[model samples]
Target: MAGSFFRVACQDCENEQVVFGKAASEVNCAVCGTTIARPTGGDAEFTGSVVETVEAR
Candidate 1:
């Protein structure tokens, strides 16, 4: 199965960004550089609020 993408809103800057569900590296906010997602060996752990889930097409 393929992993999905997520639209996350940063808590500090409220910047929205798309992140991979199985991200290998840490995902940061574009505006503030806040840690939004972290790799957990499988699905990434999100620190910010998830605005939407993007399905793979």
Candidate 2:
């Protein structure tokens, strides 16, 4: 709800974070703080035509 970012499923807490940018690539979970999949050139991952948001509140 702040800026354009990427959400990675926390391996523990299952929360999302805005760890993405034009140069920013790798991201850690906002809940668990675990390293998620490194996006290609800060690109967001998608599931077919829908973007996958593997995060939990």
> What lDDT score belongs to each candidate, Candidate 1 first?
0.93, 0.45
lDDT of 1 by residue, 1-57 (tens): 689999999999999999999999999999999999999999999999999987763
Count of backbone collisions in candidate 1: 0
Q: What TM-score, to 2 decimals, does candidate 1 have?
A: 0.92
Who wins the lDDT comparison?
1
Candidate 1 displacement at residue 42 in angstroms: 0.2
Model 2, 1-57: lDDT tens digits are 323544445655656454443324555555565666455554544211213433322
Q: What TM-score goes with each of the models?
A: 0.92, 0.37
The residue-level lDDT of candidate 2 at 11 comes to 55
